[model samples]
Target: MADRPVPVKDLKLLDIKLGQLPGWLASRNYSPMGFVNGYRRGYNRFYSKYIDVKKGGIGGIAMLLTGYVLISYIWNYDHIKHERWRRYH
Candidate 1:
């Protein structure tokens, strides 16, 4: 016979220490400005590493343009389909 599963409450792994709460929260970058700053920092790093002309070259530019064009096409796909249908009918 298979062993039965144990209930989560019976496990000691889920225990939390109240004393660690403040320190944990303080260590995290949780504020709105902090989020924006973190995002900008990450984006800058990515741009420099992959999207910038010096490091990434033509391939990166091509990928960026292709992505933009793909997104634009998807965004206007419904409109383009409607226009084609209107013209045909």
Candidate 2:
């Protein structure tokens, strides 16, 4: 890999573009629900590709539900154990 000298003009242009990011994001209306909706849309799109409704919708729902249950259990297991131990002690 070789380092190339960037022209001052190009550097200044890049700086100006980067500086506009915050203002651009602020100008657009974004909400927490919007973010959630976007995530759900993306997840559904990706999941749909691997899931076949013709075979059965239950299979897809079951997979997603089981994944959610396992992840939630693993994530909270430590906290739950801590609370239980505290109560016992």
Candidate 3:
């Protein structure tokens, strides 16, 4: 049988005592190395999910390209309109 999911009420984020605050803060890595490692882990996850050709395949590439084109058009829409207006005047 599959294991049941834990209820959210069972987890306490703000219910910790003042005495545990120091230990809890210390346990979370706040160093530069920690930042670099965290960035790499996040990047790897993003690449695997959206950028890797073998994993995301052609659909991901097409989506990314289409999104880029759409954003570019939206960003330059005002300038394009101005240029067209100037050409007619």
Task: List model 2 lDDT by residue over 10-80, tens digit each.
Answer: 34224546766565455433689878876887687757765755565566778788999999999999998
Q: How close is candidate 2 to the true structure, as a TM-score?
A: 0.38
RMSD of 2: 10.5
Instruction: List ranges where model 1 is wrong by over 4 Å.
Output: 1-35, 51-56
Residue range with the least summed lDDT across 10 consecutive positions in model 1: 7-16
Clashing pairs in 2: none
For residue 23, what is the lDDT in candidate 3?
64
Candidate ordering by lDDT (highest first): 3, 1, 2
Cα lDDT tens digits, model 3, 5-84, are: 64433424476567766665666567999899878976686668888755456766687689899999999999999988
The numbered model that scores best in TM-score is 1
Task: Choose the strongest candidate by lDDT.
Answer: 3
Best of the two (2, 3) by TM-score: 3
